[model samples]
Target: MDVFEVVADDVRRDLLLALRRGALTAGELARTRSDVSRPAVSRHLRVLREAGVVQSVVDGRRRVYSLRPDALAPLATFLAALTPPAPPVPARALDGLDLEVRRTTRERRTAHGAAQQEESA
Candidate 1:
């Protein structure tokens, strides 16, 4: 499984989040979540390990798991490539836009004779 597939599981994602703080034993990880059984957590850990999302090593009789952030580089790079660059910002604000609108309206009213009617009233 790729890192993305391994991380698709809710249980696996939670395990990754927990490991982000630091490495933890399988037992410690299992204890953090009551919804998943220890065996299930172990299975998720194995998947993560195989996908290179996490690494494990023996600490005497037990194993400790830690995140491998480099495993996500491909996904990050792919995303960055897909994202379009931001549109260029305008050089200046349209400060005279309201004034231009008022001038246009006045010219249109004068052409239609409304300006003369308003002035005589």
Candidate 2:
């Protein structure tokens, strides 16, 4: 399967995310979530390995897997291209709002000061 097809599966995606932290054995990957069985995880891992999304190494009797981040460069670049640039906010757009806030603050302070003076008198 291709990278896109391999990643389309939720279990395979989860396995990739778990492997992102570091290399993990099949058992370790299986333990990442409780919903999937060990055999299911192994199947997902096999698909990922076949797709070049993950690399595996023999560590004694265990096979450890790690994410091949570079393999995802095409997908990342494609997604980045698809994202539209953010629209720029016009300058002074909030000037009226700012002025109203300042006016409200001044009015409140003046009213408070007048009340205090009246109480003292």
The top-ranked prediction according to lDDT is: 2
TM-score: model 1 vs. ground truth = 0.67
Q: Candidate 2, residue 12: CA error in Å?
A: 0.6
Q: How far is candidate 1 from the true structure (C-alpha RMSD, Å)?
A: 12.4
* Predicted structure with the largest TM-score when compared to the true one: 2
> Any runs in candidate 1 off by more than 4 Å, and if so which?
81-84, 93-121
- Colliding pairs, model 1: none
lDDT of 1 by residue, 1-121 (tens): 8876876789998998999999999999998889999999999899999899899999999999999989989877888999999987564555477678899999997777976787889
Q: Assess every candidate by TM-score.
A: 0.67, 0.69
Error of 2 at 101 (Å): 33
Each candidate's clash count: 0, 0
